[model samples]
Target: MTRKKYSKEFKLDAIALVLEQGYSRSEAARSLDINANMLGRWIKEHQAQDDQAFRGNGKLTEEQAEIRKLKEQVRRLEMEKEILKKATVFFAKETK
Candidate 1:
């Protein structure tokens, strides 16, 4: 069977059902037709990140996004520095 993907809202609702609604994890999972283990994991994730939980596919958390952007900028600057170094070496040779 193909795996199912739940939205952030759905996961949050499921967690709320167990936490705020005082439903047992197994009860919530059975009522939602999802695995108990899945519900437990969702609860943990929701508790860990609260409003920032379940960012979905291809989406990054704020820290992750900032780190990715910084890494890309560092790569670009390194490439530019390498090119400049090569140009300086070539110019020095030409002046000899």
Candidate 2:
């Protein structure tokens, strides 16, 4: 079965039920029809990340985006280096 995707706002609301509304984790999860363990994890994430919590798909933080771009650039540079190495070997053979 495909996993269900929760929106960031939904997650925040769920977290609020526990923090602001004083609902126990199990009670919140049961009332919301979600797993208690999942609710616990969401609470932890909310505590740690605050505003940055529950970033949905394709929405990366600035640091993560920069890292992704740098990794792509490194891969492209490595491929170019390999092509240049092959070209150098080809020219050296032709000169002999």
Candidate 3:
């Protein structure tokens, strides 16, 4: 069977049925014709992302993208700093 893809809005509405409408996960899943575990996973993803939930493939939420960029920058800076420190030590020994 081909895997089904759910739209972000559909996932959000399903989550709301459980969260805002106070339906149990199983009930919501049954009503939506989805697995209870799938509904639960959707709820977890929705809670983790809030408005950013269910961004499509190859996309990162703004906060997550910024964090990844910052981490890369930090790693680059740290490597540069390490190289400079080694260069300084090498020069000092050469000057001795």
Best by TM-score: 2
Off by over 4 Å in 2: none
lDDT against the true structure, each candidate? 0.92, 0.96, 0.91
Tens-digit lDDT track of model 2 for 15-81: 9999999999999999999999999999999999988889888999999999999999999999999
- Clash tally, candidates in order: 0, 0, 0
The alpha-carbon deviation from the true structure for residue 55 of candidate 2, after best TM-score superposition, in angstroms, is: 0.7
Model 2 residue 72 CA deviation in Å = 0.9
Error of 3 at 50 (Å): 1.4
All models, RMSD in angstroms: 1.5, 1.3, 4.1
Global CA lDDT computed for model 3 = 0.91
Better of 2 and 3 by lDDT: 2
TM-score on alpha carbons, each prediction: 0.87, 0.88, 0.61
TM-score pick, better of 2 and 3: 2
Per-residue lDDT over 68-90 for candidate 1, one digit per residue giving the tens place of the 0 to 100 score: 99999999999999999999999
Per-residue lDDT of 23 in model 3: 96
